[model samples]
Target: MSPMILIALILQICVTNVITGEYSEVVHNFKSIRKNVALSILVIDGDESNIDSSSLSSAEFVKVPNIEDLYIINILNSLDKNIFTSLHRLQHLKIEENELSYIGPAVWAGLDLEKLSLRNNQIEKLDNRAFDGLKASMIDLSNNKLRTLPNKCLQSLRLYKLTLANNQLEDIDLETFGPELAYADLSNNLLTSLDVEVFSGVYALLNLNLSGNKLTSIVAAPTLKKLKVLNYSHNQISVIAGNAFDSYNQLMELYLDHNQIFRLNHQSFPSIAPIKKFTIDHNYLTGLSDELLNALDNLAYLKFGGNPWSCKCLERVLEFIRSNKIGTDYCESKLIPQGHSCVNYYDKCYGNETKILSQNFEIYKNFIKHYEC
Candidate 1:
C-alpha cells in the first residue's frame, strides 16, 4: 500500500469507467435506430439535407413536402424501384395536393393495396386499367375533375365504401360499380340522367347520394329491394312513375326535395310489409289526391312544406287530414281565396267558418231542385 500501488489502481479504475460508458452509449444508439423503421426523403420544404433515400424501410410511411406541381411520374421515379418491387403487401398510400393526371395502366399492378386517398389532385380522367392490381375496399377520389367512369371500371373490387363526391361527372352508368358496392357518394355533380340498369344487380347497396344534380325523373327499379336510403335532392324531377318504387320494400328514407315536381301519384310508393318515410318538399304541387291519402297506411313521416299548393273545390284532402293522424304536420294556406275552405255547388256558399260539408241538408236539396227543374 505505497504511493506507486495507489496510483496504478486509480489509473485502472478511470480506464474501466471510460470503456463502460462507451459501450452503453453505443448499445443505446443501436436500439433506438432499430425500433423505428428508417425513413427517407422527409422533405420539410425540399431542403437538401432531409433527402436521404438510402436508409428507408420497406414498411414505413414517408411524408413528402408540399410540392404540388411535381407530377406522379417524377414522384414514382424518386423512390427506389426496389422499394415497391413487391406490390402485394402495400396497405396505405396517400398522395395529397399533387398535379397528377390520369392514372396510367399498370401503375398499381399486382398490388393488394387498400385504403387509398388521392385528394386535392387535378385528375381529369380515370383510366379503366388504373386499378388493375388493387383489391382495396375503401377509395376516396373526391375533389377531382373526372367526367365519367368507364363501364365496368370498378367491377372487380369488393369495396365497402366508395366516395366520388365533388366531381364533374354529368352522367353515371351504375354498371361501373361491382355488385359488392355497399355505400357510395355521388353528390355535388352534374348528373342529369342515371341509368336504371346501373342498379339492376346492386341488391346489397345500403346508402346512395345522387343529390345536387339535374335529374328530371326517376325510372324506379323493381329489383332494388335492399335499398335503405335514396337521395335525389336539387333536381328537375317533375313526375314520379306510378310503379317506380314497387320493389323497394326495405327503403327507410327517400329524399326528393328542391325539385320541379307537380304531382305525387297515389301509387308512387310501394306497399311494404313494414312502414317507410317519404320527403316531398319544395315542389309545384297543385293538390293532394284522395287516392294518395288511402295509399298511406304505414307512412311514418311525410313532409310537404315549401310548395305552391292550390286550394280549390277539390280540397277535400284537408278534411281527410283532420280525420286521421297524419305522419307530419299538414299545414293549410290561411291566405287562400277560399280561406282554407272549399265551396262547391252542392254545399252552401259560406264564406269561411264552414267546417262541415253540407252534403245532406238544404244545400243538397237546392242543388237537386236547380238541376231537376
Candidate 2:
C-alpha cells in the first residue's frame, strides 16, 4: 500500500481527541466519552485560568491509557506536583506560552518522554531533579526569563540537543549538562565570559553558538576536539588567544565577524587542512601576517572586506590571493576590472596599483617583500 493509504488506514483504526477549555471543563468533557476506550493522542489547550488540580486527581476522570503525545498550552496557574505523574507512556509533552515560573522535582517522575518543550514561558528556575526519570532526547527552554542554570539541572539525562537562547543568562555552571550533548545554543544573552572547563565532559558536542552576547574573548577548552561549527560573532571580542583553537581538529567553519579585532597573531590558528570557510569581516583589522596567509592555504571561502586596510599590507594579501587563485568576489574593485583594492584608499596605494599582483607578479612580489609588518 502507499504511505497515504497506510496513514488513512491507521487513522481509521485509531481514536484521537482534542480538548480545549478551562481544566475543569476539559475534564468534564473527557469524562463524557465512553470508558475503556484507549486514547491515541490528547491535546489540551487551556483557557487563561487557573487549573483545577482537584478535578484531575482520579484516573477515571482524566485517564489516558495509551496516549503517545500530549500538548498543553497557555496554562495560567502553577502545575500540581502530580499533574503528569500518571502519564507513564507519554512520549512528547509541550507546555508552552504559559505563566509558569517554577517546576517541582517530582512532576515528571514516571514519564517515558522523548521530547519536552517549555518554550515562551516565564520560567526562572528549575529544580535539579525536575527531569530525573525522563527519557528526553531534546529540551527547549528558549525565550524565558532564566538568569542562571541551577547545578545538575540536566544531569543524568540522555539529551542530545538543548536550546537556552534569548534568556537573561549571565553565567552557567559546567556540570549542569551531561556528556551526551551534541548541539547547544546560548545566544542573545548577557554572558560576558565562559570558563574553559565548561565543556570538559561534552565530548560529543559538534555545534556551539555564542553569538549576540557580551563576550570579550573566544577561548575554547581543550575538550572540544570534535567541534565542527563555532559561531562567536556579534560580540565585544578584541583579543583571541593564539591557541584558542588548537584542540578543534574537526572544525569546518569559523565565524568571528562583527567584532573589534584589530590583529591576529601568527599562532592564532591550528592546522587548516579541514577548514572550508573563514570570515573576519567588519572588524578593525588593518593587515594579516604572511604566516597567517600561509595557514589559509586550504580554505575555499575567505572574507577580508569591511576593514581599514593599509595599502602596503593589502598588497601582500592580494599577492597571496593571486598566486593561489583564491576564488572570492569581496575584494574586487568597481573602478578597476583587473584586481581588488582597498575600500578606504590610502595615499600610498592607488586603485590601479592593485592590478600589479596579476599583471606584474615578480615586481609586486619584490615590493611586498620590502614592506615591513
Candidate 3:
C-alpha cells in the first residue's frame, strides 16, 4: 500500500466472539457490554507467526482482565517486546495492517495510552525509547516508513492529537510539538518548507493540515492566531506572504486550493478576518480587493471557483458571489463575458474597479496587457 501511503484509519470494533472451541475462550459481547476481553485480534487471515503468547491463545487473559479497546488487525511481522504487558486496562490501542518493522522500547513498557494506532505499518524505525512511558494523547503515525524525528522524540508526550500524516516526513521538529498540540496532520508529507518558527511550539492550534505537500509559499505567521482549521490545499503554492495569516482572527476553515496564484493584494489579507469558510480555489486568481470583498462579509462558506476573472472589474465581487449562493453558479454561463459592464478600470463597479484584472491566460496574456471587456 505504497503510493506514498494512503490512509488506513482503523477502529470499528463490533464485538461478538464467544465461539468456545478450536482456540477460543475469548468472550466479547459489546451490546449488553459483557466485554470480558477479546477486543478484536483480527489476524487478517491468520498463520505466519509473529504476535507472541501464541496469538494470545486466551488463558482468558488470566481471567477477565478488564481490557480497554485494543485492536491488532492484519497480523504478524514484529512487535513482541512486552506485547501489551497483560493489558493493564489498555487505554485504546490499534496497531493497523501489519508487517511491523520495528518498534521496541519494550513496546510501551507501562502503557498510559489514551489512543495510539500505528497505522498501516512497516515502521522504518523508531526506538528512541519508543515512547518512553507511553503518555499518548492520540498518536497515529500515519502509514509509515518514518524517516526521522528525535528531538527527545515527542518531548515526553502531552500531545493532543497528532497524525504525522502518511509518513516519510521530510522535516519536522515543531520544537518537539507540545503545549497540547491541538490537532495537526502534516498532510501527505515530504514538506518542502515550513519554518514559521515551527509554529513557536504549537500555540494551541486547532487543525492545520499542510495538504498534499511540496509547498512553495505562504509564510507570515504570528504564531498562527489560534487557527481554526487551515489546509494549504494541494501545494506548490505561489507566494502568499505579507501577514499570510498573522491575524487569522480565529479563522474558521481556510484552504488555498491548488496553487501558483497569479496575484492577490490589499496586504494580502486581514481586513479584520472573520473567515467562516473560504477557499482560494484552483488559483491564478485575477481579481478581488474591495478589501478582499469586505473581508468576505462572514461567508458561511464559499469557494472561489476556478479563476481568470476580471469580469468587468469583477462586477461587485461577482454580484457578491452571485447573490450569496457562494461559489458563483457557473459564473454566468461559465466564467462571465456575455455582455457585462462596469466601465473604466477604476471608475467604480465596487470601487477601484476591484483592480482591473483580466490578463486572459496565455500565461498572463504574454506580458500582461489586460482589459478584455
Candidate 4:
C-alpha cells in the first residue's frame, strides 16, 4: 500500500486534459467536459502546425468521445487522413515532440491502437504504405531521424514492442519484423554491421538491444530459438565469433560491455549453459584462459571490471576471482581486489600434519618464492 501511496492514490483518480489554443481550441476544449463525466488522460496541447482530420471530425463535441489515452503536445509535419475516425475509443497514442515528417496510408486505417509513440520525432522516412493498418502492442520510434528501415514501412504491423532507440538507424529489415516480436530496441544506432540473417525470421525475439552501436565484430549468429537478452554493449567489438550465439535454451543476459574485447574464444560460451548475467566490462582483456574460465559456469554476475590485467598472469586471474566470489564491484563502488607480485601465492599441502604460512608470512627481501616438495 506504499508505492508512494499507490502513486498518490493513482494521481487522485486519474483525470488529465491539457488542451491548448488554436486548431479551434480542440473543439473548444471538448465542449467543456460532461458526457458522463469522463477523462482519464487526454492531454492535447498541439496545433504548432497541423492536425486536422476536419478537427477530429469534431468528435461529437467530445465530452467523452471515449478517449483512451491520447497525448499530442505540438504535432507538427503531417497526419490527417481519417485522423482517428472520430476517436473510436482511441487506445493510447502519443505524438511526442513533433517534427513528424509524414505518415500516410490512410493515417492509421481502422484504429485499434494499443500503443504508439512517435517518440521525439524528426522522422526521416517511411513510405511503402507507411504502416498500412497499424495494429499495435508497442511502437515507440525512439528519438528519430531514422536512416534506414523501410521495407514496406514495417510490413503490416501487429507489433510487440519495438523502440528504435535514439536513432539514426543504419540498417534493419529483419524480414520486416513481425512474428510477434517480444522486444527489439535497437539501442543508440548507426549499426556498423550485423546480418547473420538473424534467425531467418519467425521472430519471437526476447529482448535484443544492440547497444550503443558501431559494432566491429560478433558475427556468427543463427539459431536464436527465442533469444533472451543480448545487448552487445557500446561497441567497436574486436571479435567474438564462435557462432556468435546460435544459443538456444533461452540465453540469459550477455552484454559485452564497452568493447574491443581483445580475446575470448573457447567455443565462446558453448551453448551458454544457462548463463546468468555475464558482462565483459571495458574490454581489451590481457588475460583470461582457464578455458575461458571454464566456459563461464553458473555465474550469477561476472562484470569483469575494466580490463588490462596482466602481471604475468594476474594470479591465475586472481585465482578465478578469489575462488569464486566473482563480484569485482562492477566499475567500483567499493573494489579492493587486485594483486600482482604473484599475489597471495597459494599452493602447498603435504599431509601427515601440514601447516605452512596459514598464519604469518610477509617476505619481500629481494623476494623470489616457490616451493613444491
Candidate 5:
C-alpha cells in the first residue's frame, strides 16, 4: 500500500469515531441536568426537552406542554408523563393551556402547595381528596367547563383568592370558601341566587364580583366591613332592600346595571360616605326621588342613561343638567331632543299647560362643584 493511502485511511477512521460518540455524550449530559431536584415551586413553560435536574427533581411545577403554547395540540403526548413528579421542591402548581381534562390524585401525592391555577382548560369535575394537602394562597378555576365545584376541592385553601368565572356552575354553597379569602370572582356562571351566609366568615374580603348570573336580588352580608367593590350587573334584580348596603362602610363602587329596577326609595343605600362611584344604567326607571339618592353625598360618578325618563318629574333632573350639576351631556344625547327645557316640563301639555311644578334647581349648585356628571 502506498504511504499517502495509509494516512488517508487513518483520517477517515478518526472522523467516524467522533461522529458516533457525539450523540451519546449529549444524552449523558441531559440526564445529569435533572438529577436530585428539590424545590417547592416549578414553572415548566415548554415541551420537547430532556430535563434531568437533580436539585428540582421533587418540586411541584406548573407545567405547560410548551412555552410556545403549541406543543400539546401539535403532538399527542409526545413528552413523557413521568416528568410531572420529577421536581421534589414543588409545593404550588399551576398548569395552563395544556390538553389536560382530568388530573389524577396520585400525580401530586406528596406535594405541599398553597396555590394552584388551572385556568383556561376543560376540567369538568374535580375528584374528592384531589386537593387533599394544599394550603394555597389562591386558586383559579376560571374559564373551564366545570358544572359544580366540590366543597372539598376548596376546603384545603385556608385563605386565598378563589376565581371560578366563565364556567357552567349552577349551584354553589356560600360556605364552601375558606376563611382566609380576600377576593372572589364567581361571575359569568349559571348561579340563580347566592346564599347570604356565604360571606359571613370572610373578614378579609375586599372585592367580590357576581355579575352575569341568574340572581333575582342581592343578599349581601350584614358585616362585610372590608368590602370595597361589589359588581352585581346583568341579573334579574327587581328589588333592592334598604339595608342591603348597611354594613359596608368602606365600600367604594357599586354596579347595579342591566336589571329590572324601576324604583329606588329612601334609605335604599346605607349612607356610605366613602362611596365614590355608583352605576344604575339600563333599567326601567321612569322617575327618581331625591330621597333615593340623598345618602350618597360623596358620589362622584352616577351613570343613569338607558332608561325611560318621565318628563313630568324630570324637571328636577333637567334643571340640574342645565345648571351643570352632574356635568353629563345626558340631556343633549338625542335620546331626549327637545333640549333641557321641554324635558324639564314639556310633557304636561294639554290640560296643565300653565301649571309649572315647583322644582328647586338652585340648591344643585353645590352638587355641581363636586360631580362633573
Candidate 6:
C-alpha cells in the first residue's frame, strides 16, 4: 500500500481503539494516535471531577496542525492558554457550562476562528485583547455574568450576529462594535438610557432588541436608517421625540407595549415606509389627534387598547379605526370598554356608554363635530 493509505489505515485503527475504551490512560491514548493525520474535530464532555488535568495537558493536541472545530463542555477548570495556540486553522469553538470566570488576552491569539460561543458560563470579565486574533462572524456571549464589555475587545472583528442578552450591561460605547454588524440583542439588561450616538456606525443593522430595560424616552437618532424590526417594550418610556423615527424608512415592526407614555408627538412617524405591525398597548395615553392618525396612513396593523381614551378623542380614534378597517370587528365591537373608558373631562361617558357611542361612527362624528372637549 502507498504511504498515504497506510497512514489513513493506522489512524482509523487508533480512532477505533480510542472509541472502544481500549486505552486506559488519556496520555497513552494521545501518544498512540497517529500524529501524521490531522485532527479535524474534537469534542470533550463529562464531569469535571473525573478528568485529569495533567493527562489533558500531556495529550499535546496543540501538536495537531489542522484542528478545525472544538467543543469543550462542563469542564470545571479555566481554559488552558495552550489549547488553541497551535490551532491556526480552527474555525468554530464552543465552550459552555464551564467554571470559567475570566478570559485573559492571548487566550485565542493564533487562530482564525469564525464562530465562537461562550454561553451559559460564569464569565465575569474579558481582557481588552482576549479576542485579538479571532475573525469571528458570529459571537454569542449570552446568559453570563458579564457586567461590562472590555474596551477594544470587539473593535476589529467582522461580526454579523452578536448577542449580549441576559447580562448586567448598563451602557455600551458606540465605537465598541464595528459598522458591519447586522443583528444585535441587548435585551434583559440594566440599561437606563441610550444616547443617539449608541448606533452611530452601525448602518447595516436590521434587528435590534432593547426590551426589559429602564429607559424613559425614545430619542431621535439618524444611524438607525436600515433597521427593520425594533423591540422597545417592557420599558419605563413616557416621552417620544417627534423625530424619533424620522429617517427610519425601512422599519416595519415596532413594539412599545407596557410603557408609561401618556402622549405622542404629532410628527412622531413622519415620512416612513408602511409599517406592518405597530403595537402601543398598555400605556397611559389619553387621546390620539387627527395629525397623528394622518401620519399613520401606511399602518397596516395596530394594537391601541389599554389606554384611558377620552370620549371626544375616542370618537375620532374610532372613526379612524372604522374608516381604515383596522380590526376584524371594528364596526360591531366596542373600541374602548372597561380598561379603556373615558376619563377626566369626559367622566360622564364611561363604561358601556362610551362603548355604545363608539360603535356608531357617522352619528358619533356628526355629534362630536359640534361638540367641544
Q: Give per-residue CA lDDT, model 3, range 189-257, as digits (tens).
A: 888887777777667878888899888887566766787888988887866766687567778788887
- Compared with the true structure, what per-residue lDDT tens digits does model 2 show for residues 4-28? 9999887755433233221212322
Off by over 4 Å in 3: 1-105, 109-112, 115-124, 127-137, 140-162, 165-184, 191-208, 215-230, 237-254, 261-276, 287-299, 303-313, 325-373
Total backbone clashes of model 2?
0
lDDT per residue for candidate 4 within 102-200, as digits (tens), equals: 566667767778888998878887767767766778889898888887674664685888898988878776666766777888889898887777436
Candidate 1's TM-score: 0.63
- State the lDDT of candidate 6 residue by residue for 7-120, as single tens digits: 999999988975754431222233443453346666566553455422234246555556577676775346655457766777888877777778877677666677888988
TM-score for every candidate vs. truth? 0.63, 0.76, 0.32, 0.31, 0.66, 0.73
Q: List the candidate numbers ranked by TM-score, top first.
A: 2, 6, 5, 1, 3, 4
Error of 6 at 65 (Å): 5.4
- lDDT rank, highest first? 6, 2, 3, 4, 5, 1
Per-candidate clash tally:
1, 0, 0, 0, 40, 0
Give the winner by lDDT: 1 or 4: 4
Indicate the residue-level lDDT of 250 in model 1.
81
State which candidate has the highest TM-score.
2
- lDDT, model 3, position 352: 28
Better of 1 and 3 by TM-score: 1
Where in model 2 is the C-alpha error above 4 Å?
Answer: 1-38, 46-62, 312-341, 344-373
